[model samples]
Target: MTTLPASAHWQPALGGDGFVEGIDDIRQAIAIILRTPVGSDPLRPDFGSRVWQYLDWPIDRARPHVVRETVEAIRRWEPRVKVTRVVVALDAEAALKITAYFRLASSGPEISAEVRPK
Candidate 1:
């Protein structure tokens, strides 16, 4: 007997109507959540993280603030993972880097994702 894999959610794929499954679904979902500015969605005024507010500020100061907001937003919105830690840093040439460490709710495997704010 063969068992089929379970799909968590479906999201539109780039340039088409096809959708992605499983871990990719969560990754894309989280990316969209982080990129959207707070209050941009009238129906969900508090849907996004506050990272955009600090995007123009100095990286040293923005790091902690970004981490805090990202962690809080993830905890509130995304139920698929439990955030372990968030590390915000400035990459070479001063681009902001946000790395989040988390554990999958279903399989308990550790994962990390890099996020960029719009």
Candidate 2:
């Protein structure tokens, strides 16, 4: 299990988006991973997630896909944490919203990040 660097645990200050250290950084990183389409990056073809493919798919049908894609991507890319749960839902606009819950692999409180993958 990888632990966040000592500075990272207390480094981030509140930003305009209300993101802080540990949570926001991890959240943002996960969001980026999920937003990126596999094979888009020329150098690392396998550095992204497949969640975006299901964007056009119906939410009910896409839920499992989102959950699976996110869990695996997080597991592979972010060694600092382990995904515990991923919830998929639709907003009033019918857009998809993915909320993921995870904790540091080295042990810590569970943290959740909500990402509306485009």
lDDT of 1 by residue, 1-118 (tens): 5343467476675445567667777777777778888899999998988889999898888878898889888888889888899888877767777888888876677788887665
Top of the candidates by lDDT: 2
Candidate 2 lDDT, 36-70, residue by residue in tens: 89999999999989998899997788899889999
Show model 2 residue runs off by greater than 4 Å: 1-20
Worst 10 residues of 2 by lDDT: 10-19
Query: Deviation in angstroms for 64 in model 1?
Result: 1.1
